[model samples]
Target: MSWREEHRSNLELKMGKVVRLLGECEQQLIDETDPPTKSRLKSQISELKGQMRDCQGDLDSFGQEQVTQRNLALTMASVTYEDINFVITALLNQRMISIDGQDNFQPTNPEEKMYKNDLTHNIKFFLDMGLAKAGEVRHFVENNAKINFPDVPERLKASLNTEYIKLIRSGMRGDELFMHLYKFSSHNNPDPLRQAAGLAVLCYFFETCDVFEP
Candidate 1:
């Protein structure tokens, strides 16, 4: 009838066609019979939902700040292969270092033994990575400032450095080379102080352990 009314009717017809097209698409997807394809589609839908939830959480926390977004990206980049390798070396092989006073530092119980072993493995990993050396271990025992551990915190570094000096001065000799590992392995020692002492010793061992043989 009227020009405006005709235009509105034409728009409604276009909207109806679009709705029909969407419904047809839904029906076609529903008719798919491949089990693997269906499983994949379901997995994709689940992932999208999880991602939507994460996006919603992020928006609530920081709300569209481009700088925050960039900071997160940078932080992710910082936690790469080298960082992971170093941390794993620290945690699993405590022998990568050498703490001082190994003679006075015996763990009195079985739990201490376990802790010592784990720390020893961590030390081995560090040595394998070339983060430490045997001569450095001996030097640290005589005077800690000689040995360098980049990832160790400053507060802990002083204590660890002291341990290295103590281990060598106390008598880490010959077959007793494994004394550091035995003292620090997670399975051997449970006392936090003892375990930590063991870790320092292991770092020295890793630094100095005979890499050529093993």
Candidate 2:
């Protein structure tokens, strides 16, 4: 399932549970006429209401902050090193990049190499998965971006460019800027392939747009 869908499902599940508990509390509070018992039930009901509010707040944040990708969280879990390596090889074959003996992208400049070298595996990891799904992941990413960015490719490029400019102005070096972009894209996710997917998408944009310079 897509990450967005899964996240929504979890939030909905929590909301449902909170609502059910709230109903049970209200019913018990109404049935208990004893002053002390009623007071306890009221306290319990209040807590449940607070929990319900918290759940609602989380749902709202999910709606607002998690704007865009419906990433294939489950699909990413099964990727292997060999699969990523093959994708890297394919990229090299396509003349998208040149590889060294260690199979890392050999960019022309030291700065470019420093920026992309550390995340070589991660970039390849998502590339393999994206193409394997017949570009399903890639298509959804663009589709999702279209919600706020009507210009499709150009809007996407502008968004990344803004971030790149901000990072540069903030005194971040090439390597640091690259890492910032990766983490920003991944939402600092702990999942390996998911994080890799973030880098892969960034790499895609870099190729198709002018986000970074050599």
lDDT of each: 0.36, 0.49
Candidate 2 regions with alpha-carbon error over 4 angstroms: 1-138, 141-150
> What digit string (tens of lDDT, one per residue) describes model 1 on residues 1-214?
8975454334333332332233233333466698887776556545544543443354344344423332322232122223323333454443335543333232233224324433343233222212212222233344433455543433233343444445556866332444443343323544433333333344433433211111
Q: TM-score for all predictions? A: 0.21, 0.35
Clashing pairs in 2: none
Q: Candidate 2 on 1-214: residue-level lDDT in tens?
A: 8998677667555554554455456546646789999998889878876775565566666654322211332333233343333332332232122212222232344224335544343233233333233233344445545674444444444555566767777887545577687665554667666555555556555543345653
Worst window of 10 by summed lDDT in candidate 1: 125-134
Q: Give the TM-score comparing model 2 with the true structure, all chains together.
A: 0.35
